[model samples]
Target: MKSSRIGRIPIPLNNVHVNAGDPFQVTGPLGVLTLTVPSVIKIKLYQTMIKVTPVFSNQRASAIQGTVRTLISNMVAGVTVGFRKVLVLNGVGFRVSIRNNILTLSLGYSHPIIYCVNRNIKLHLISPSELEVFGVDKQLVGQTSADIKRFHPIEPYKGKGIRFINETVNLKERTKKK
Candidate 1:
């Protein structure tokens, strides 16, 4: 059986504790995260290092092994260093602000769009057009940023919309008439 490349690598713990059980739990300085380990994959702890191995030598088991390893790795990283996502709005009359757990956005629309912030995620406005999303879970941070950007996605014409920090938009040229 060919072992999964990523599953063969051990995950190192840095000031983090893992409870190996039916419902696995990882605790760090930031917070604690719990996950259900798949029956096909087994999690073993060797001192500060964690290893994920497939219970069966089947292809499906190998796939699950790699996936479980990555999920656990992400959880450990999230609880330790956390995750962050930045969004920037481009164009005139674009603004974003957070107040009283509510995010207010004005994307050149008739009215402002309001989004309620999640308890686990923190939203900050660097500028009127720049927004920052912070959370312990990578999925949560990315989803929040995507939800906000969905309100005014980048247009191919004017490039006026919400985008990531390094995201670039390709603007289309205007049509010429005789």
Candidate 2:
């Protein structure tokens, strides 16, 4: 069988150095990240590019190789330029602030919610209700954003809560009083 189409597209090393092994290590200006390779996939390093392949030609191997290739690609991009996620709190009396890697959030609750920020992730408060999550690891940045958003997801009635920069939420009308 032909090699996985996505896996054939070599991943550009850019400013990152990749070490292929049981757990691939990607080092760059941002920092270092490691990804444990699957048992059915193989990785080859080159001067300016990295190639991935499947150990077998079966259906599962091909799918795994493609996934591995995309993940490594994201890793390279993550190390080179980094990743960011923007979140907005859209409700009255909702506010957030960061101090010493700790987030004190007031989301209309009786008491503020104190959140401990991740060491690897940088939390930047653009405003009282808007914030940005920055990190070299794409997964970490996204995970942190999701965790914060979970505190108060958007309500269908008011469409108020934490939302990503590009997220779209539909508001529902209130019930009529007879």
Candidate 3:
């Protein structure tokens, strides 16, 4: 058995309905999500309670069961509270703006970079140096943040580039002349 798979995920304070061998449905404050678990895993659901277990004693089955449970729990939390990613632009003239659903980035480059926003995601310009990305799907939010960061990744030398709000860049020291 996978020792790391014995953890239990807490269900959010919302309505959850589970049907054996079928997809589980969760309705929360943000939205609703459905998750389908494998037949090798067994799920028990009661009023405001959910427990997932592996049918077999195999380690793979236990790991899969834990993964499925965590995924479902995250989905429920995401739909209820949503997800947000913040990005900061660090450069002399690096800035970002959103107009008509398009994100225009000027990363101290010769030409501006324009990115078309997906309908499911919402982008907000908190300031010229700050951006806020919001979406119900965690993958979409993370992907969008990565895509934006790619335009100008944080440089270790000058640390001048786009980076996540919580990201920390290790700046390198300048070498002395021999």
Question: What does candidate 2's lDDT look like per residue over 112-163, in tens digits?
Answer: 9998988999999898889999998888898999999999999999888889
1-178: candidate 1 lDDT, tens digit per residue: 8768999999999999899987999999888888899898888898979999999999999888888999899999999999999999999989988898799999888999999989999888888989999988888889988999899999899888999998878889999999
Residue-by-residue lDDT tens digits, candidate 3, 66-88: 78777777776677778999999
Tell me the spans in candidate 2 whose CA falls farther than 4 Å from its real position: none
Clashes of each: 0, 0, 0
Residue ranges of candidate 3 with Cα displaced over 4 Å: 2-7, 15-22
Give the higher-TM-score candidate: 1 or 2: 1
Question: What are the models' TM-scores?
Answer: 0.96, 0.94, 0.86
Give the worst 10-residue stretch by lDDT in candidate 3: 3-12
Model 1 spans > 4 angstroms off = none
Could you tell me which 10 consecutive residues in candidate 1 have the lowest summed lDDT? 135-144
lDDT of 2: 0.90
Q: Candidate 1: TM-score?
A: 0.96
